[model samples]
Target: MSIPATESDTATRALEVLRRLTARDDATFHEGQLEAISALVDEHRRALVVQRTGWGKSAVYFIATSLLRAQGAGPTLLVSPLIALMRDQVAAAERAGVRAVAINSANAHEWDDVRARLAADDVDVLLVSPERLTNPRFREEQLPELRQRTGLLVVDEAHCISDWGHDFRPDYRRLADLVDSMPEGVPVLATTATANARVVTDVAEQLGGDVLTLRGSLARTSLRLGCLTLPTSRERLGWLLDHLTDLPGSGIIYTLTVSAAEDTARLLAEAGHAVSAYTGRTDPDERVRLEEALKTNELKALVATSALGMGFDKPDLGFVVHLGAPSSPVAYYQQVGRAGRATESADVLLLPGHEDADIWHYFATASMPSPSKAAAVLGALGTEPLSTTALETRVDIRRTPLELLLKVLDVDGSVRRVQGGWVATGQPWEYDEERYERIAAAREAEQEAMLAYERGGTCRMELLQRQLDDPTAEPCGRCDVCAGPWYPTEARADSVAAATGALDRVGVPVEPRAQWPQGADRLGVDVRGKIPPGERPETGRVVARLTDLGWGGPLRELFAPGVPDGPVSDELLTASARSLRDWPWAERPVGVVVMPSVSRPQLVTSLAEGIARLGRLPLLGRLDLADGAPDQTSGGNSAYRLAGVWGRFAVGPELAASVAETTGPLLLVDDLVDSRWTLTVAARELRLAGADAVLPFALAAVG
Candidate 1:
């Protein structure tokens, strides 16, 4: 099998591959699929295809790889973002008799074999994640040769390359360098289903010269769209409980956060529904199992987060129900597009909530790098590479944000990650204020558009299409606004009661910090390595986390900024008491001690006194803030946080005398816990002043 040697011959070969891939004897290319394939196999040109989901984007690449391989071109190199996408693509390629292999975090054990296959020309297509592009061994040794001889380069979910898009990834931004390094006559293809006109233009500019762009209508006639405004999370859960079984078939229930997904899945399962939760925290092996279960109709729904978003293939996912509105219409469109790809019609519904805006604000700000923080990170690095743990001691950013900042710096050429860790590249870097501002403004506009969709004045499907700048936007006549809701909106009274009960049940373990953060001694703190067993606090309990589905609402209200300081509410007090009663501690505390609070003095005092009175324990005096100690806000890396509170709390004469008299562990109470550093510092002070053991209790834990 050599090169076809003619365009007609190439098309004939590609059609055969497509039929094999689809397992259909009469299969043919969709509207623009063959043209894109021809551009790659015949003309060897760059192509961008922005079609709806399930429009055979993968087929274009798989067929092109087959033709190119027959023509004696080098194996196709594919850059994918998610593991699930790679897994599914590998399976699909095998059906066409194209040998495909992948190298990613989840399959590290097979990397050697995969590399051997590539070396022996046993692989027709080689897939690697965008993050792997920067890996030391692969980037330095293999990628250079592969770039020179590559037959075709494909970028799946190409919208991620542009920062203007909703889900911009720093790793994807590095693809421009890879594109520039490709040899002459090597074809390139970029495909995505969620890019709007703005994103399309940005991606095109990055893909470089004379790319063929093929975009089709974004409308999905098989989707029946609708919106139900449910003000509370409990009500939304009740609605699902009442109507989940009534929906067409096995489908997805999307959530805005991991805790919401877990909580929803638990409540539904308790009601005798076969369901499970899927999120970023879920184990990779278990994710594969759950995805299979849904495909086989073994489970009713998998309440999942955006981690399950892109490249998951199920032809007949009967419905998609959002537990809460996503931050933007573009993102919402991408998620709901997962349904109705093969079915005649699939249900799509949005249950909008008031707390959605707050969650949106948190996520939007968390990803963007701060100028001051970036500078701090850069200043901490030098000729020697420092691991993230060591670097955390010198910078004020938290671990997650610190890692994100480093990736952005890497993309900007200000730093480089090597074998040991990261080092400064000494390259000049400037924060793009104007670009970030424009992106922020665009996001605000998208959020407003999403709100308008929820308000329901126009055809639901048309509104989503217009948001994507689809030229074929029009009424689908399948939405609630086009043709009244095809499903019910009411939840039975008993269902609501069940949901309320689930939400009200509370108590989460607050695991004690075992080891001190690395390089803490550099911050003028003497601690390093693990804390001594005697000085460490016991595993404690919180009434709930601020992110919990049930008690989160009240906890958020109580800690919201600008709220007037006040005594503990009776409702929270009762819940706290209940939590304490149910805690399975090895030893009960003989007394209670309070940590001084500047922000909520009245609330902290009241909570401590009430707990002491209820439990018949003495209320020991509170620890005092050292003279001129600055107030600590809940943010920053562990070492920086520890530095702020080092020697900040002092057990005064009265508290010291009371501690000396007590015989058992003392209960340490605080209004809220973020990093748990404050509680650690206060507990250390109490232990040294002569308490036997300390147990931490908090009103709420920050997610």
Candidate 2:
């Protein structure tokens, strides 16, 4: 079979590239993969690829890059979202004979070397985070040159470009700026596996006019989907204890929070299962090891937050079990799609929690910056770059929300981040109230759909496909809904008890603040350097983190907004007892002093009284709120939190006189520990008074 003369060289080169990439004598494109490669390499046309997970989407870009580089084009620019995904992609690309390098937060030290490689034309592809675009140093120093020479612009997880996407990034929306500045005939490719019709349309529009959109059926026949509506966290944990080993191979156990992932992994490990916790806060090196452990089947599962989502490549993953539902159906489908990629069958189960809706609300509301907050952030920035900590002093917003709002402002051209910190660009900015409201509506709708998926009326797979707007969606006849439940419904009492025992084990190290936040002096706090070891409080105890499995559910309910603040619940008191029993404190307290929780006075006082009664200690008195000072708000960045409470509390003469007679350490109790600044400030007052030590205790700790 000789090639015809009319054929282009790109197609022949694509074939050769595919063979080398796969290391197979006989390797062929999967469905539309070849067409996408040809469009970028041969026709120099932009393309959008929407396919199911494990459909070889990465192959298209890798093959196209190989062909283009050989044709004398410059390196491809790939912007990915997740660090874990980026590491996996770099490894995969290297295995395929492509030289890929990345500049991300995880590998800051190697960026200079990577940049050097890029300049030498020795790198076939260069990857970065979308957040890198808003960086003024990168934007002014590197991006212009790279943009001029980039052969192809690849947005991997392209659905993130649209706010309508389940996992949208404010930074991803900045791709429109990159697209607008691209050189003529420099082809672009956007790829995603979990986009609905709306997201597809939004992404295609960003890729510019005359873009070719290639979408395939979003169906994975190898996946046997099921949903178990477990009534309680205990039941869900019990089911996992009983059935995890029965799953065919290693996979993932998805959790909604980092604490959940950590707790789940700890429980599984205690039960003699080889499991690892993968969360956003996990050290980069540890995350890599965990990912490798899963890939090599050395571990049964990686208990994970959505931090593990987007680009992990595990072809033979046997199952994916969700302890709580994600906020949307498309997001759920994308996660479950990780399994059954190369195998005959894989189990996919969703165990929805009663708190799933509340968790969803927390995340959803967190990402959206109120118009006033956004304006305040912009106003806070100046020509002189301000670090995030400095900006926190100028704006009342908390860390997570402030970071998100800054990114949104950067995308809107109202701010720029330089070497030192972020600066205002002085560009006119609009609130776009209508747009924000529209996205909020979409989120609510998606949330409702997710809840419906849990309720389970139609084929589970069919419902997910429809949520993705798959035209070919139909009854798969392989899901619990269509074929009836294929998983166990009952969990033994012993298993449940074991899980409960793990959850009930409560005590967290209250690491003392080693150094005061820089710039605190401007806020009227004169403290700096390590608090003299003598002034620091003893290690404290909290009932549990609000995200823990055992006590997290009830504590969240108790603290739910609009619920009246009252006395300590018996469970909390018992949990506190566990903390007291386990305390490695040098000596028990002789008296109890209450920190005035203006927002929760009754709860705080009751918790202190309960501890005093349990210890047979005297209830000294409460720290008085400064005259005319408002009760402090709960949420803010560390700097603002400290500023808000710095001068707001005073140890009145009555409390000082009462504490003088007390012996040994004094128990300092509060309803919640958020910033720990409150505890630190209160302890400083107590230590100044005559108390030998101040041991802080709280009902819950919030991260």
For residue 631, give model 1's deviation from the true position in Å.
Answer: 4.9
Q: Write the per-residue lDDT of candidate 1 for residues 378-451, one digit (tens) a residue.
A: 89999898999889888887888888889999999999988888999999679999988888888889889999
> What lDDT would candidate 1 get against the real structure?
0.90
Give lDDT tens digits, candidate 2, residues 526-568.
Answer: 8776788777798898888888887877888888889997888
After superposition, which runs of candidate 2 have C-alpha atoms over 4 Å from their true positions?
1-8
lDDT of 2 at 289: 88
Report the alpha-carbon TM-score of model 1 versus the true structure: 0.97
lDDT of each: 0.90, 0.87
Which prediction has the highest lDDT against the true structure?
1
Judged by TM-score, which candidate is best? 1
For model 2 the TM-score comes to 0.96
- Show the colliding residue pairs in model 1: 3-71
